[model samples]
Target: MTRRHRAGALVLSGMALVLTACGSPAATDTTDAVKAAARQSGDTVYPAQVANCGRTVRVDKAPERIVSFFPSNTELLLRLGLKNRIAGQTWTDQSPPKPAYATDYRKVKVLAPGEIGREALLAARPDFILADGEYQFDGKKLPTIAELAKLGVPVYIDSAFCPKTTGTATLTATTTDLTALGTLLDVQPAARQATAETRERLSAVDKALTGRPATRAAMVQIVDKQLYALAGGLYSDVVRRAGGRNVLDDTVPKGSNFAPLSAEALATKNPDVLIYHYTGAADRAASEKWLRTHLAATAAVRGNRLIAVPAADFSELRAVDGTVTLAKSLHPDAF
Candidate 1:
């Protein structure tokens, strides 16, 4: 069987073991007691089972020590008021925590500037781990999901980065993830509140732009002079929710998140709005200038409709904020 199939089988087998254990009379009695206590205290039930990626992550209790592998995952935890639970975090050098989370983010231990080595991760004594992508558990440079399971550590991967994920992310999917995290962490109330707030904000955006036409837009990144456009996935969803249509959605292959675009192709599409992502203001200015000089014939350049956004905003948790930002830019009068 292929590697993916093998991994799926392993996950299914592990879930079966979990179900078997929970089925035992002693385990069921304890679980019932815990649930009764939690209900009395108005807390989430114990042993929350969340389907993550292709694995069923069974959390018997809220994790006290969580190692967040990406800024997006870290931010989500912080948003849920679980800053104290984060034992360590990584990948904050290029994209620092959002302004609202800056203080709490600073207090967390920096496991590494980029990917933390397996040794450092284990040293943190993390009871739970949150990763933004499947690439983190590649098993060569880092510990795989099965390996972590063997060590009694449960890992949750963002569905947006799941291997089988395709098309674009939706607000519903985003809230589903938030709800799952909340259940696993025993913070269902907080998660529900956050989800409500997100829906309300997006609903306002939708109400405002109800009859307005969608602006044809394209999100692109310039690296060493080559141009890459966001063709699908979270960014594409952001654009769609923000009263803009991603011009490259139909141009790129299905399930492709990003692809290099030729000057000719970009000029041919001539999107109404061009969003250029960058790490810093200087980089943003440079990218805009490059696009203007290289694809001067495009409507985005000629009409001065170029918008610059931080590259970090394209992440899972931040995509909501990204949508709001893009909507304001695309339909300034609506807001």
Candidate 2:
């Protein structure tokens, strides 16, 4: 769901991309790092090794101070009952993942919508950091997870945004992330509960869609004046699960996730539904107006089948809720 990619396994020795993802299981240094990080974050300490997002990261114990570098990461942390452990958060553009407790976490540090220097992050001394990737991170300074690891800080990235990932994004991948994070944080129960609940929600949606026909659709994300067609990555998974078939699935190689959408081609192959991703209410209105005025003759527009999704929704842990919303909207008669 994040366009920016964080550094991946290629750079890490013995990552899933290399050496059978093997490394020293856990050394004294690992234990020491975990203890120290725990003290800073005020969480319990334990040791764990993870092959995450194609890379290996060792966590000695539960972190007390966890920095969430993306909205989705923040949502995951909160949903997993680690809100108090949040040392810092980025991407504070919309309603926070925990609106009811926004006032409670108001003192948490913010580090985004602009450049975040390595020094600033180090000063926060977070034990762990969760990020979507570097795709959206740009400003006066850029920092890599590799750099943080060197300083004894561990970073976990959502594999959905990994550039090296092959094929479509799967619900399995999201569960894997949750399981791995929970294991590392000593909160496996919470992770399992969250994943199970998400599955149950999706199952309910599936039941509602049992007799429904899927709509022909296209999911598009427009950024920097460029259109990115949703082929078979995270967004497509949502579309498919919601009873829609992406029209752009065959536009590219089978394993490729997304590519620049061709406007002319879209004009000719206009779909039954066009779901546009936009950030902020203003952007949503503008994007819908532009799509309607520019392609009013298309069946999707003429029939008012344009679905405007908040761009930020897909990044959060509750993203599946958005899928259910889409399915219900597309098949209002079913419910």
Best model number under lDDT: 1
| Model 2 TM-score, all chains together | 0.79
Global CA lDDT of candidate 1, please?
A: 0.81
Worst 10 residues of 1 by lDDT: 24-33
lDDT by residue (tens digit), candidate 2, 148-227: 67767788878676666635666556787887887777677788898898888889988988977889998886666667
- As a whole number from 0 to 100, the lDDT of residue 201 in candidate 1 is 84
Candidate 2 weakest lDDT stretch, 10 residues: 1-10
| Candidate No. with top TM-score | 1
